[model samples]
Structure formats: structure tokens, C-alpha cells
Target: MVGAVHSLGGQEIPLRDPADFLSLVQRGPSYLVREWLFLAYAVFAVGEGVGLYYLTRPARSIALWALVAFSAGILIGIVQDAAVVAFVRQFPSDYAAADAMTRRALEPLARTVVAIIDVQQAVANVLLGVGGALYSVAILRTGVASRWFGLLGVPAAVASVFFGVVTAAAPRLSELQAVAEYAFGLVVLWDLGAAIVMLGFRDDARQDGHANSPRHRGDRPAA
Candidate 1:
């Protein structure tokens, strides 16, 4: 039976068998849900990249390159999701049998699949970093986006680089790999929040400009 264990977080968690932990952590419903969530975000990021490319006409070259890179990155994410699904589906239930099965039937295949995904992910991360850097440059040069938003892009690009490096060095420094993943996730959430804030700020500025214009002054009768 599973038992309750205390974690470093000062929270009690259920301690299950190794097989159960593997299933829950790597191959269970939670992992599946995360994969689907990643797919959804990939869709949003691709759409946003397309919209940015069209809206920022003055930075067309940079926008276009960023679009291409983001699109490639999303494609790689999709492929990785597929591999993860496959791996999870093949995971065995019994720990002892699972080890044997993995070694005999799944390990080699899973390793190869993981290797391909890792390489693709590394390329994707580099492309993502380049795209973010280009976007930041475009934002700064055009003065269309907020400076703070542009600044956030720098760390996002750095995180992308870290992701690529950590992924390539995985299994050796697995702890660092986990940290990199968490850092990337946080950066993405921060970037999304920044975009929302920038949109609001831009709209407010536009409204203020219209209200202050002389054309609007004549529309209002004398007090």
C-alpha cells in the first residue's frame, strides 16, 4: 500500500512503489495532460508569432525570421509530445517486469527516440533564442513595444540557451536539467504576462492621444 511521506516542501505526499512513481511522474494521466497543455501553448505561440509578423510591418525581416523559428520550435514540440506519448504507452506496470521489459523491448527504442527528441529540442531551443533576440531588437528599434517587455526577452533568450545546454547534457546532470525546465516554464509565463500588460498600455496611450488631439477639442462645445 502507498504511504504518506514528508517532502522538503513541508507537505505530506503519498509514497508509492517505484512503478507507481514512474507511472505517475512520467507516464500517467498527469504527464498526458501536460503534453496536451504544451500542444495548446504551441498553437498559441505560433499564432502569436504569425500575428506579430504581420502587425510589425516595419520589422518585417526580423518578424519573418522569428515566425519561421517559432514555427519550427512548435513543430519540434509536437514531435516531442508524440514521442512522450509513445514512451508512456509502452511503460510496463510491474516494476521487476518493467525493468526487464524496458531493457529487452523498450530501452533501446526509447533511448533512440529520446535522443532524437533531445537533438531536435536543442535545435528548437536555439531557434527560439534567436527568435526572441530578434523580436527584442525589433521592439527596441521600432519603439512600438515597451522597453520593459524588450528587456524580458533577454532573459527568455538566455533561458532558451540554458534549456538547450542542459538538455544536451542530460542523464549526467539530471538535476540541472530539471532546474532548466522549471526556469523555462517560469520565463514563458512571465513573457505572456508582459505581453498582456504591453497590450493594455499601448491601448491606453492610443486613447489618450485621440482624446488630447485638437480635432477632439472642437467636437466639445465651449464650457
Candidate 2:
């Protein structure tokens, strides 16, 4: 978004104005980079969710739900990013060269994309938040990570959901949006912590595997 603002001479482009938005979109390279960055985020989120699903096996059900919600959210995000690149980005050049009548016809399509983007963003945020919270619960219950690390996700989830709801429902609430945005740093922190622990901490991983094993629960071997 900062890149976008910089591209627009430090002024924010209003989505309500298709002309301004397409003008920004016309900067193809930067636009593609920005969209791809979001795509990368979705991809990484999927990986993290799957890893957590396996690592938090002591709380398998919650982790499964978390993985489901997180994966679903990222899947929608991935589709939305693909839609922007495949569909929305194709319009700027066409719109630029079109006559007044043609431009008017194209505007509705752009607006529809904007509305879909907003809806997808909101649903993604809510699902991710629920997933993150559940994953945190699993982590806490399993002792796979430190308490502080697990607790970090709760506020991050809250902030994400709050920002998503407010942005979709009432974008004019800039103050609340700002607060939520600031709090979203926790999400980054939690992601980093989770990755570090899940990858670097072999003892925790081994313990998780052992804890979930039937033989560890004193089950008899099958004949």
C-alpha cells in the first residue's frame, strides 16, 4: 500500500474512482510485484498452517480446524490475487484506449471487482483469525511452544478480524482501522516465533510425535 501511495505521488487512490485506480494499475511492474507479494503471503500461510496441524497433534482436533480455517482463508486469498492479475489488471490498458461509452461500460466491471475484493478480504480475515486463535490454543495445550509465543496470536487474531470487519463494513472508521493495523504486528511476530519453534526445536517436534503415538499411550501391539 505504501508502494501504491508512492506511485500515486503519495496520495491514496480512491477505489471509487476507476480512472485513478486504473492509472495506478498502469504501472505494470510495480503492480505485479505488489500483487505477487500478497500471493506469496497466502502461500506461506498455507505452509505454516499445515506445519502447525502436524506439530500440535496433542490437540489434534483443534489443530485440524485451525488448519482448515487457515487453509480456506489463504485459498480464497490466492484466488483473489490470481483474479486481480488475470482479470482486473487486464482492464487498465483497454479502459485507457476506449471511447467514452466503452469506458462507461468497463467501469461497472471494475467496480464489481472492487466489491468482490472487499468481500473476499473480509472473509479471509475472519477465517484466518479463527484459525490463528485455534492454533494458539493448540500450541498452549500441547506445550509445543512458550506461553508468551502462543499468547501472541490471540491479539493478532483479534486485530485482524477487527480490521477486516471495520474496513468492509465502515471504512470511514479510520481511527479503529489504524489501531487494528498497528496491532497486526503481532501476527508477524507470532508467525516468526511459530516458524522458529517448529523448525529449530527438534525436542518439541519429537515429543509431539511421541505423544500422539498409540504405543506411547500403552496400547497393545496388533498380532
Candidate 3:
């Protein structure tokens, strides 16, 4: 939903100029806010992680912290997103008209800002990889909810680990970095699928409990 809304705001800006990036933000303040939804995404991830922790706690205790670690990475990554917006906000309104010395000064600062974001992303990816790997192993071991989930998780973890290395090693490769983005997307999708499975099957557990309860004793034939 957020991505759809952002696309409506404008097309992509070339990175050759910081001024262009600032102007893009200025042109669509709402879009900038939409992009800030990265924080919201992290918040939801934390909620999901905590719930998963409790759900699998009985048999898969270690997976819980790994899920938490993934959430932690996201929380820290939000700051990097904020820094990006801050840079855009700080850029002068008259950047194009600025003297060469001023433009030169700002360019390096902009590059530095982008580099900071890249490095932070690499760290977050690493944390996510660790979390996904641990959680996948736990799922397979416990078989508490769904084996399909475990199967999905194993590959998801691999993708996370693969992309984490890519991001750390090749931060400047925009095209190659897209694979990392897709890998991250895979992890996100797995979480969504797992949530659905959890919700759908919760009623079965309740039914099983009710069937065995003393309340059902009178309904059954005497043994």
C-alpha cells in the first residue's frame, strides 16, 4: 500500500545530484512520510516476533531470541532511514545556485551520508541472517506448528545470509544490491505466511482441548 502511494508521488530521481534528491522530497512531503513507514514495518515485525516467540516457546526456545534479534535489527535500521530524510531536509533550497566550493563541500557530505546508510544496512542484514538461521532450525526441530513453515524458513534463512554477505561486500553495486532486497522480501513474505498459518490452525488446538475437557465427559458413553 505504501509503495503504491509513493509511486503516485513521482518517479525516481537520479543520484548524480543531492539537489535532485532534496527537490524530490520537497515535491512530495507525503511521499517522504510514506517512506518513513520503514519504522512502522519494524514495529509490526517486533510484534510478530514476540508472538512467534511465545507460540513456539514450549519446544523451540532459542528461535525466540533469534526472532527478537531480527526485530532489533529493524529497529536500528529505522534510524538510518531517518538519517536519509534528515540529509534531504538539511540540503539548501538553493543548492543548484550555490558556489562550486559549497556544492563540492555538500557533495562529499552527501556521499558520506549515503555511505552511513549503506553500512548500517549491512549490519542489519547480518542480524537478520542470524535470526532467520536460528529460527529455521528451531522450527524444523520442534515441528510444533507446521513442517511447511520449517521448510520455507530454511531457504528463507539461506536467502537472508546470502544477501547479508552481498550487502556487506558490495554496497555500491546497485544492481547486485537488488538481489539483497529480494532476499529480504522473501523473509518478510515467510513471516506473513507463518502468521496466516498460526491464525488458521489456532482453532484446531482449541477444539482438541475442548474435546478432552471434563465438560465433554457427560456427552461421551461410559467407558
Candidate 4:
């Protein structure tokens, strides 16, 4: 299967036999690394949601709702990643007749797994879209961060919408699924960069200090 995937992409990689799948599970640490990364991002997103909830209070109830939505989105993302990893780990190899038989035996289960992934992906995208819109509005109204951060929301929302459309049309254009996956990865990278910037930078002028920091708000005069 790995060789077939590589051939499709003009690369070469050894295909794991079905019997080797257990060994791959034991030997390969890449899956663990990927899971760690997904968990790390999920934690970061939760932190951001918490921060946003605190920062956007006293004026708009929307921010609080956004925080909840974003947290849910992050949770969904984590689940989706885990599900994908699980699916990969369980995929039967096409190298041997035994593997083919195993795959046939698991076909029903595989379909169920795919269905769950599809549903989770749809939920994640919708939540992300809602969260992005809410965060953009929060930034605009409160001026709690650079408006440039809000620009990130545009692509994020578009990607969410595109993902839904592409996924729905996946059956019609199976070959284009790879392209959709690539596009989604690009958008995720963009979002991760934006999140890092938002969390790291301290643009005092753009921040709603009074709203974000209670102690500082009472101590300093509003600009």
C-alpha cells in the first residue's frame, strides 16, 4: 500500500505487508509524533479560547460563545486527527492474498470508520468557521489585537467552506481528494501561524488593556 501511494506520487517507499502492520505499529514512532503535535495544537487552541473568553467580556456575549465554539472545534480537530491515525494504522495491505482477505473482512468496519471521520470533519469545519467569524468580530469591535490577525479568519473560513464542498464532491472526483487534502493542510498552517502570532505578540496599542487585564485597567488611564 505504501509503495502504491508512493508510485501515485512519483516516489518510492516500501509497502508494508499486512503481517508487517503489527511490526510497523510497534516500530514506527512517527504516528506517535503526529499525535503529539495534534494534541499540542489542541491545547494551544483551548488556551487561546480561554484567553479570548476573558478578553472579550463586558460588551459582547458573542466572544464567550466563540470561546465555547473554538474549544469544541479544537476538540473535534484532535478527535479527527486521532481517527485518521487509527484508520491508517488499521488499513490492510494489498501486497498479499491474505491481506486482501483481511481487507475484505474489514470492509464494513472501514466504511463505518470513514463515515465517522466524515461526520467529525464536517462538525470541525463548521465550528471553525463560526469561531473564526466570532474572533474576527471580537478583534474588530474590541481592538484587542492587530486587525491583521483578523485577515487570517478570511482564509480559515474559506478553507472550512471549501473542505465541506470538496468532501461532499469527493465521490465524484476521487483523484482530486489529494488536492483538497493539500489545500486543507495549507490553510491549517496559515491558521497555526496566526495563532502563534496572536499568542506571542504584545501590541499594547492594539490591545484592549482594560478589557483584557483588570489590574492594569484600573491602574492606567484609557488611551
Which runs in model 1 stand beyond 4 Å of their true positions? Answer: 1-27, 90-103, 172-175, 194-223
All models: lDDT?
0.61, 0.74, 0.64, 0.59
Residue pairs with colliding backbones in model 3 are: none
Q: Tell me how far the alpha carbon of residue 96 in candidate 3 is from the true structure, in angstroms, after superposition.
A: 6.8
Q: What is candidate 3's lDDT per residue for 131-164, written digit by digit as tens?
A: 7667766777777767788778777777777676
* lDDT of residue 176 for candidate 2: 71
Q: How close to the true structure is residue 185 of candidate 2, measured as C-alpha lDDT? A: 70
TM-score of each: 0.69, 0.79, 0.73, 0.64
| Global CA lDDT computed for model 3 | 0.64
Given candidate 4, what's the lDDT at residue 215? 71
Off by over 4 Å in 2: 1-13, 170-175, 202-223
Error (Å) of candidate 1 at residue 222 is: 29
TM-score of 4: 0.64
Better of 2 and 4 by lDDT: 2
Model 4, 1-223: lDDT tens digits are: 2323323231111133444444434433444344455556665666666766665664377787787787887788778867766655445332222455776565556556666676676677678768766876776687766676666666666666566565555456556666665666645764675556556554543476546675755666457
- In model 2, pairs of residues that clash are none
Comparing candidate 2 with candidate 3, which one achieves the higher TM-score? 2
